[model samples]
Target: MKATPITLLVCALGGEGGGVLTEWLVEAARLAGFPAQATSIPGVAQRTGATTYYIELFPVLQSQLCGRQPVFSLSPVPGALDALVSSELLETARQIGNGMTSPERTRVLTSSARLLTTQERMQMSDGRRDPAELLKLVRAFSREHQVFDMNAVARECGTVVSAVLLGAIAGSGLFPIERRFYEEAVRGGVPHEKANASAQASLRGFAKAFEIVSQRQTQADFVSQVLKAQAMDSRLRGNDAGADGNDGRATALSVIPAEAGIHGFPPPVREFASLGYVRLADYQGRSYADLYTRRLRQVLDAETAADPQAANGHAITRETARWLALWMAFDDIVRVADLKSRASRHDRVLREVKAGEDDLVKVFDHFKPGVPEFAALLPSSLAQKLVAWDRRRIAAGKEPWAMPLKIGTHTAAGMLALRTLAAMKALRPRGSRFAFEQKMIERWLDGVVQGTKRGWALGHEVAHCGRLIKGYGATNERGKDNLLHVLDHLAVLPETEAATHAIAEARAAALADDAGQALDATLVRHGAPKREPKPQPIRFMRRPVPRESMDERRA
Candidate 1:
């Protein structure tokens, strides 16, 4: 017999073992030799709290050819579910609206409404609706509905209702798994025999209920069987088509947005799609050049779309094109042997100078002669040295005057030096000169990293640090206020030094306060130390009598 595809949705409160039920089905399907895929939204509201889980299963036939198959989420296609097993009634209603179930092809096994409602909580703080009312709603949507007091069954069996619900889903006769699959699942999940016994009892009860429903001809077995078969055949064909290279397989692209921890600017849609999900893991370790190229491609695409007078008439704007070309050319020169190192060395020197080191002047003097005349014109101490040298030459009658030169600020020079170091690091691989050049071009295409007008920059350490400090305040009111005082004092110190000294001060203050409080408590418990006056020192007056005796003897 041909196999069928079945989608089973298990919905419950996030902490109420919904995930456990889904896992049981997955294991059962696997043991039954059925092909299956499961996806879930595991938490509430992105990152807030708890969330629901959704599972879908597909049974494969023995006669089918083996090949790759597409994995789909719960809501991949509409009206594709064969069974809807919900832990709560409201969730059943939600699944129906989300296209997770079809009235003609789905079997719904749900608990009656014992869970608290939003309105009940708002009004009474402990309101609950009749379980029978919830069952009525399920019956209205499902042609084959089985309502059981699984909560009571669970209590009698000495277990929770979740395992009982899983047993009920197994007994629904939707999956091709054997009885042992459910038994083993219960054994693995519940651990205790009493819980397993509860699940078995629930299964037996659901089986009896299903038998009565089946006898009435109320079950839409024929429709469900047909749909399941059609779904299986489609999967088999899709696998075969993918194997034959006639139909493209579903590409799983994982997008790591710029905001998602990546350091570079956001790339254009086309470039973003090119890298796809394959290189997502490489985002962290990628070379600056590679990141730049990827970003440049995006910018170029955007510029091309917005421009009007290119060779393609709609190609990149002339200004952007020129800028990109100039950047690439500069990148080529910058990639020369030791250029990156030279630049890094320059940056290091500047950093040392900023930190109050005066030796950087010596390093600057060594590289000054080779540096461009434009770079020679700076307010740096080295520039002063160059001016002095020119004046000396003119006095010696070798030169008439100093030549005009342009230079960069200490910060700009430092940036240039860092870029050089990055370039040198890229050149370590042999036979990669051209590749390095291409990467340089790409990096140049991406714009410079700069702070915003308000001095806030995306992904800046200071910005994140500020946010952390603010969040600490919101975390706890009184404790945070004390900490804030310490932080304020620390902020006045240098950024580099504040972290260590401020932390030490805050800790010392807290410890001292704790010690003083402990002492006060000790005094309150055992009484204060006995009061006593300190003795005064005696004063000597024999000096005056000795001097008078010496004066009388002299007279």
Candidate 2:
């Protein structure tokens, strides 16, 4: 309805230069002898902020009318938007979902790469959002749209992404301004040669987007063909015929890794085995990696014998592949030391902090290791003695003791200390905590094996319960308790409800809350009793008698 003012709505994550991009557009419009205004609402970094910038430009042919001026709104009118530029695929769809863009009017410019929302990444299971859904909405909303990997374009030019977005706006050609105005806006204060590289990347992004728009119809047809092919492939592979989703046995068997020593097994088994081997190898050493392979081999043998036809695509091995690898490479003090001491970790830290070539960087690691962490390294008898001492201290109105270590990992001696501790991975199996975790893993694996003999669905549920036993220290202990409780309590239920849905419901409940309240509610729903609250205790503190004054002692 407001034809005189061209409106653009930009939706971007924090630090992708949304405000800078808006500034560039405003400058370009003004440079071309047009009246323009831009404003932005600040947003939080990553996924959770309200960062939207709005711009309105009114074309003025001449400066003849001194008294006349144009009015522009600070925010975009939802259905009247002329352009929508988004840094992410989902955000593009989100704006459209909000009815900000009309199919008949707006041109959509978006990057297809995903940084994934925090919510998507934090799920207890595979939490990635599907890209396919966004692609469909991209087509439905924009009258003329261009989608490409803008991040790659920016990287190629060795510059930030604001220039690339500016280039995209110029290429859209909705405005009558020459490209040089946009280029001048960038290269004004900077040198021509240095600025041209940025200008070129911006222009390249613009041209790429324009081409996509021109050939969009053909692109849509190709997408349709790809979709049909995928559907046919899924049918042939029997991906959707069962409850395991697109992860069918045949498909899993078809994507075997080319890694050595796993060729004897089928594709699915080889895939997971290779991953477990690599993970454990990195977490510990070649010997431990071999141990993981041997365990996987046992599961593979059982799976092959029990389900020779490979129903559920050797789902048992698939589940073991994930949980077993995670369980075997449990986090510990030794593992922390190993990670921190690695040269690769040092290099990564340097890169993250963006240290200069001549800058001297010092890194200090702070650790407050209490009795438990210390006990993991000592012999059982020594560990018990140390724990008893801490208990005695606590009983005498003192806090449980901890040795706070300010490890200067930046210094030669500090780095060496950590590296020595890292080298103790060979002695890890003898540690009390390691032995305890290994026993727990063995029990979980046994449950999986038993579930498989009873039913694949039940086995799958049990294997998935490995998600319950995660994290280090207290969290790990709580997860272990939940897993064992479920196994013990649910084993009594009939195979039908317990295996098919109740187990999954219980697992969901466990993940729903950190305090185990949701898990208790779920357990109660499934005929298990609610957990009783622990009894509270109060103790009186006795202060030490003050020493008598010198004068009083003399008297």
Candidate 3:
């Protein structure tokens, strides 16, 4: 029988340089005098799916083929891959789910990093897939696996993730090609002028990945070593945690700086409360943070009175702590401007683009604020008139009024504008949106407290309803409506397992779909009235007759 070619598959999202990595692998194979072939299937878009590159290399050198060319497959067959490399955790699980991996054959190399998929982002609640489950899937299917944060390594080396992936593949020893061929391939792939610098950065990423994969036998051990190496290297560069007065450790919640003034709550509730306290403090001020804690304490007391034994471990209060903080810090133009103009944000942009310290980077922030955004900050009477006027315009088939702004955040003028807008946070409390949000928050909080008095499960379900109150503008408004509907219809129902289950189902339905159709169905099933549909503009447009039809009519 003819010698079989070794099959390898690479999976990466758009702009992560999957194509460059594929070219490098093929070029390395060529440099090693091995006959290689490669093919790729492009994915729909970034995060929807990963583009997969399939390669087949005749294990034997071309010089030894005696002019007999071995055939290669354009795509990988299920359970036949020798190696599978992926840049994302979920995409790795996706490949395994396709039955492309085998315990006896495939060596999987994947990054622990995740880019949330469109499906994950669409859910109203926490829609992320469990990383642990994805990792378990990877481990169960592969003969061997080396999983680490390739994106982190790339950032550290100031190179693309493709370099790190190439290094990991080289270190895995799946290919018969030597390491030098791979290095030469990376160098050859780039152009001149900054070739040496580019090659150095790529090599740094390659070496870091190569060392991590080659030295450690397990993922945990590899990660530990990598962290230790980072620590040591940072110390050498005089940038250690001591230099910044932070060890980058969070082994215990009590050690968190946010724990200040959050003393009386139970452990579970305290953890979330501490985080919430810190977030609210940053979003508004210490007084606003105090207000959040005070509200949380009220829920805790209610939960404690209901379940003195702490059987549920303050589950209601814990959930409330998280969602309450987020609700209180509702996004406004001020928040956006503050975030855009922050020094840390500028530094993060520079780092993400791999800009050197001396590199000049220009950052522009685009915004389109409609009448509604402006009306949010106006007094109630004025805001109502403004919004009504805009609605009237929409009803008249005219587009609602909005101003599109493009600000160069890197320039002095842009910085001034953003800071000036950010300074308007002092005026946020007097705004119509703030008053409306506070009223809704009070309603939700009251439901949580009263539901706890009724039953623990009922209270917990009510607490989870807080998740529906998220996003901004119409999405935010829809979430609040859904939450209020649940509070009014379900929270008042007699405390029972059935009532609690109905509340849970309602919340799930609301999160499952954005249009609220599923939620309406659930509400009707539970004997609650479905939401009243809002009035929609019914405009009839006049269809123009075709020229041929008009001419025939004239004739």
Over 4 Å off in model 3, which ranges? 1-6, 30-39, 42-49, 56-75, 176-178, 189-194, 218-258, 351-361, 381-385, 388-399, 537-555
What tens digits encode model 2's per-residue C-alpha lDDT throughout 1-555?
334888888887877777777777877777888778888877766587538999887766437437587888988888789999888888788788889998899988888877778888676555777788888888888787888887766655445566667767776676677877876676664655776554555555545544544366467668879878877887988876444554433444355565554556667667677887888888877888877777777767767766889977988887787889888998878889999988988887776554657878999999777888877767677778988888777777677788889999999999999989889887787777777777898888887777766776777788789888777777787788888878877744775456547678888888767688888988888887666554333456777555676558778
Give candidate 2's whole-model lDDT.
0.76
* Candidate number that wins on TM-score, 1 or 2: 2
The TM-score between candidate 2 and the true structure equals 0.75
Q: Candidate 1: how many backbone clashes?
A: 7
lDDT tens readout by residue for model 1, 160-191: 55676766766666777786776666556564
List RMSD in Å for every model shown.
31.3, 8.1, 8.4
Give the alpha carbon lDDT tens digit for every residue of 1-555 in model 3: 237888999999999999999999999999999999999999999978789999999888888889999888888999999999999999999999999999998999999999998778776678899999999999899988889999999998999999999999998877898998998898895543446877888889999998898776566567778889988998888874667776767667455334786888887777789888888888888999999989999999999999999998789999999899989999999899999999999988988888876889999999999987898788999999999999999999887799999999989999999999999888888889889989999999999998888889888999988999888888988998898889888777764677799999999999888988999999999889999898887777889999999999999
- Candidate 1 — what's its lDDT? 0.47
- Give RMSD (Å) of candidate 2 vs. truth: 8.1
Stretches > 4 Å off in candidate 1: 1-4, 43-50, 61-64, 67-71, 74-78, 124-133, 189-555
Compared with the true structure, the alpha-carbon lDDT of candidate 3 equals 0.89
Give all candidates' CA lDDT scores: 0.47, 0.76, 0.89
Q: Which predicted model would earn the best lDDT?
A: 3
TM accuracy, model 1: 0.34
Name the Cα RMSD for model 3.
8.4
TM-score of each: 0.34, 0.75, 0.83
